[model samples]
Target: MIKPIIRLLLIAALLAPGSAFADTEYARVQFCWAMGKFDHTIYFGEVENREDRQASFDDLLEISGIDHHAVKCNTSDSTSHRLARAKLLKDWRDSEFEIVNTTFLSDLDY
Candidate 1:
């Protein structure tokens, strides 16, 4: 019984941080494309908000410096893209307009 209790305590301690991390909110985003009959998808992970998302994309463009005419936004809004889009709009600010992805990073990092 003592051994079992100790193991449980250790497991709880190990999982505590991850559980707290999950409780923290974030924006999850993804990108998809099609080629004839084939399709491809890429996951961009979670981002903070619209400005942060734009900034991240801009940073990506700056580093990789690719010429992409448009940036698609998603959250938990549109039926097709629900949860992520909604989170973006819920945290919407006038200064920022769109979100690129969501992050599991802590609020401070965001």
Candidate 2:
């Protein structure tokens, strides 16, 4: 039980957009590849511009090649087979983008 939890945390931390992996073209590709290969991953991004946020979400899905729709969900769920809305968790100036609620996975996905 503890092992699974620790592994999940480690995976999340590794995939997270940390200072070590700045958002660059190569970084985006690497992130997308890692995300596609991982069965479980949750990504959150903060951008001030709404248009940029939307574009980022599109890129995230496109680069990762995950086919999905916006559903309603929360962070407390232990299962990934749930519905959740993809919206900003906080204010618009600092938006939160989640791409973990995907319904369809491309060939590249795990």
Candidate 3:
């Protein structure tokens, strides 16, 4: 089990947007890919299935002005996922962006 202080420090570290990856186009793709692939019921509510989840992610990419087809999620880079996940977590915690909430993803016509 993680100690309280350690957990708090971890949270604090994630909350800090110190990495440039948070704003990169590659990170955007990684973020969208993760949103599509993961179970985000706590935030965006439930998706109908895997297809719907992917469709939602596609819609998100479209809405964000990104080309879904052109994106090549660099799965080899662990740092990229960490940075993207951190950015997502930070946005969720602070409610800093529209993309991080249920309303934004749910409202998309998937």
lDDT of 1 by residue, 49-98 (tens): 33335445434543543444334333321232344334333433221223
Ranking by TM-score: 1, 3, 2
lDDT of 3 by residue, 1-110 (tens): 65533543464455344324443334222223323223222123223212234456555655755432322222212355565456545544553222334434643564
**Top-scoring candidate (TM-score):** 1
Q: Which candidate is the best by lDDT?
A: 3
Please list the Cα RMSD from the true structure of every candidate, rounded to 1 decimal place. 17.6, 15.3, 12.9
Superior candidate under lDDT, 2 versus 3: 3
Estimate the overall C-alpha local distance difference test score of candidate 1: 0.32
Q: lDDT by residue for model 2 over 82-107, one digit each (tens)? A: 11112121221132223343323321
Deviating ranges (above 4 Å) for candidate 2: 1-38, 49-52, 67-110
Which candidate do you rate higher for lDDT, 1 or 3? Answer: 3
Off by over 4 Å in 1: 1-51, 77-110
For TM-score, candidate 1 versus 3, the one ahead is 1
Q: Model 2 reaches what TM-score against the true structure?
A: 0.24
> Compared to the true structure, candidate 1 yields what TM-score?
0.27
